[model samples]
Target: MKKIERGMAFASRHVDIFKCPVCGEGFEEVMNGSFSCSKGHQFDFSKKGTLYFLRHGVKSDYDDIKMWEARRFVLKAGLFQPIIDEILSLIPEKNYLRIVDVGCGEGSTLKYVEEQRTNREDAYVGFDISKKAINLATRDEGSAFFCIADLAQLPFASKSFDVILDMFSPSAYGEFDRILKSKGLLFKVIPNANYLIELRHMLYEENDPQYSYSNDKVLTLFKRHYPHAKIKKITYEFPLSKTFFESLVYMTPLHWGAAAEKIDAALAKGLNKITIDVLLLIVENN
Candidate 1:
């Protein structure tokens, strides 16, 4: 089947999870390659088989195709596999699951999760604000669905999801609380001080404020919101190829503000292995 047709079919099968962003009405049908709600708001499926839920254009540095491609390369190299495995281990075994990956850039992580659990029946939907990201995400034919959406105003219905994955992305707790089921789980990943330490050292001088990093504020805020949250620290290193190293430099935002000369210097120096230090916060909805 064509990409649009496959997307429409997926939407038709799982239309209950969707809500109109404009009027908060549930989608009633998928017709003429579009999803429409009873209130008359229609969202058309793109040629790539992805839906756009954003009413306006939102500019982001992550909208670059090259950056997303670089990310795909790095992720496919198993650099983040350990983190993904940890997340999978935490998810409760079930006959069926409804999962949504928020800020799902390029859909690599969601795709990996789906690929790991082929025996079970589950619904996987991923969304991001970047149209470019969603377009690229839909390129791969998989059971997972991709869409362009705003994090602040999610298009999914309330108490709809069994699990929510937020990987190195900004948190929309209000929207998260609304869409997640009563006994749902939210797995949020945040970087630690040593995450990409090699890259950080190469990108900035010792005296530069960017040379040092901290997640204390983020942890504090998360604890304030979910006082009973459980935290797990994951630390490891993955060997890097020359090509993979270059892709890593392009994939991360750490070098975005650095001087060109510094980035060049880092590339010239090269890296053998990179550290992956991160904290996973697990919260259960009451």
Candidate 2:
């Protein structure tokens, strides 16, 4: 089947989860190139099979195709399989539960979980602000719904999702609370100070290894929003693939503003393996 055909088929399957971004009405159906509401608010799906939910032009560094491609490649190596396992473990054993992934760049993390799970009754939706990311996400996988939408203003209905996955992505707790059902689970993963420490060490000054980090304030904010939040610190080391070494460098924002000379210098050192230390927060909407 064609990519757009697959996309429309997926849209047809989960048309209920979408809310018109402009009129705030439930989508009635998917027409030729767009999803429309009864009130006539329409959002067009791209030829690549993804919908754009942004109301305005908002450019970010995450839109780079090279970055997302690199991310797709590295993540396929299962470097963060532990986190995926934890996410799957938190999911209730049922069908037709709505799951949304906020800031789902390239869609690899959620795709991996969906592929691993046996249940096919659950509806999976992924949202990212980058159209590039969403395009890549929906390129081949038509099973899950993909939208280029903002975190602050989700195009999904209130009390819609059963589980929200915020993996290394920015969070809008207020928006999350508004969209999730009561007692809905939110699984968030934030990088620890030691996450990609070796890469940081290589890209920056030798005197300032600066590998350790604190999420105290982040946790405090989560607790303020969701009183029943639980935290887990996961730390581990994984060997780097010889082939994906360059991809690892490009896949992250860690080296974003670093001087090219410095980046080149870091690459010369030849990083072998890196640390994967992150804090996973499982909070409930009340």
Candidate 3:
């Protein structure tokens, strides 16, 4: 994947002595301030505050500005604001909290959380593998420092954070374990099977909807990784406007394969409102 922007250099930690978040191993090198494991795994260092350690490159489908803009519009419409508030309500109010947001596209979720948090301590880090997403996130959400890095191989040492937020983003259980402090909490927001049925129904054409997802699966994944972790799920629906319809399409990977002609047709239909089903899970970062 290509790196798209030049970010302002921010102070960063030198990843020296630590084990690989994914595989239990020790670091052997610290080149360019990045910690390298002896197994030949290398994670990128951020001049702006963290590391990109996800093994998978950015998804080719989600590497555009159009999708981000659409998401921005939909979120700005307050469709997901209540969801953010709900997550905040569960987090304990504290002064010196270190929070990390993974796959933070265009930084809307981080921005909203930042606004809602009663008092913040230390740092707010938002990282993603997509430079496009990180750049946009940094530009719009100045309060949270942005980094273009993989989540599976985070740069920080183990037990470094208080809270980790993963909203509609991919997960790296081991990496999260390494960075989260014992007793740290993680809030993950995923979609139910019928997340955006309207778009999926129209896009799928004739096939039965293929939106296969299960909160139980997420709970199981979390349990497998952190047996001591506690899980709580929150589900809600919000109305989306015509503008939201456009943003929702772009912001998500649900309709990436639709032909341009078909997409144009869908756009012509122009929805007055759509429904959103958001699932949020909070877990103890054992």
Candidate 4:
């Protein structure tokens, strides 16, 4: 079956979680492969089986197809398996779950999570601002409900989700709080100082300011929003092949601002192994 057909079926099963992006009204049902709100604002499912919720187009540096494909390649190679395991450990052992992945690029992470939970009934929804990313996400049939949505203004109903996953993505705490249940958990992952250090060194000199990194500001901001939030530091190294290293180089935004020569240098130098250092912030909505 086509993606739009799958999406329509999925929406029919879980239509209550969606809200009209324009009018903030609940979607009553799926009609003609589209969701129509009480206010008459309708969002049609694309041929790829994804919904577009952004009122206006937003361009992003991550919109390139090659970048997203590279990311999907790396993720599928099991480089991020450890992080995914940690996220699964935090989820409650419930019979049913409603989960959303904010800024979920290409839906790889969400798809992995869905695959791991075979015995339970769970609803997985992933959204990103990049249309290309969402389109790529729909390639995997029955993976999840993918959509193009703005994090600043989510198109989900209030208190609808049991868990929120933000993996290496920007946070919209206010929108998170609104969509998450009162006791819902949010597992946010942010890069640490030593994350991809090999590439960092290649991109800049020791004395260059960009060579060093810190997550102090991001931690402080998160703490300010969730004073009682818990943090877990995950650090490890994954061996890399020359082929896989190339994917890593293109998948990350770390090279976006670097000079062409620097990227070329990094690719030429290659990497034996890459560090996977990140902090996982687990917060509960009170």
**Candidate models: Cα lDDT each:** 0.92, 0.82, 0.67, 0.90
In candidate 4, clashing pairs total 0
Q: Please list the residue runs of candidate 3 whose C-alpha ends up more than 4 Å from where it truly belongs after superposition.
A: 1-59, 206-219, 226-233
Query: Which ranking of candidates, highest lDDT first?
Result: 1, 4, 2, 3
List model 3 lDDT by residue over 65-182, tens digit each.
Answer: 8887787777867877777878788787777677778878888888877777645644677777777777667556345666666565675567877889898888998777777888
Per-residue CA lDDT of model 2 for 219-259, tens digit only, reads: 78877886778888888887876567788889999779667
The best candidate in terms of TM-score: 1
Runs in model 1 deviating more than 4 A are: none
Model 4: per-residue Cα lDDT over 50-89, one tens digit each: 8999999777798999999999999999888999899999
For each candidate in turn, the TM-score is 0.98, 0.93, 0.77, 0.97
Q: With candidate 1 superimposed using the best TM-score fit, by how many Å does residue 42's alpha carbon deviate from the native?
A: 0.7
Checking candidate 4 for backbone clashes, the offending pairs are: none
**Candidate 1, after superposition: displacement of residue 141 in Å?**
2.0
Clashes of each: 0, 1, 6, 0
Clashing pairs in 2: 193-213
Q: Report the C-alpha lDDT of model 1 over 56-171, residue by residue, as the tens digit.
A: 87888888889899999999889899999999998988857999998999989999999988877999999998888888888777888889988999999999999999999999
lDDT minimum window of 10 residues, candidate 1? 132-141
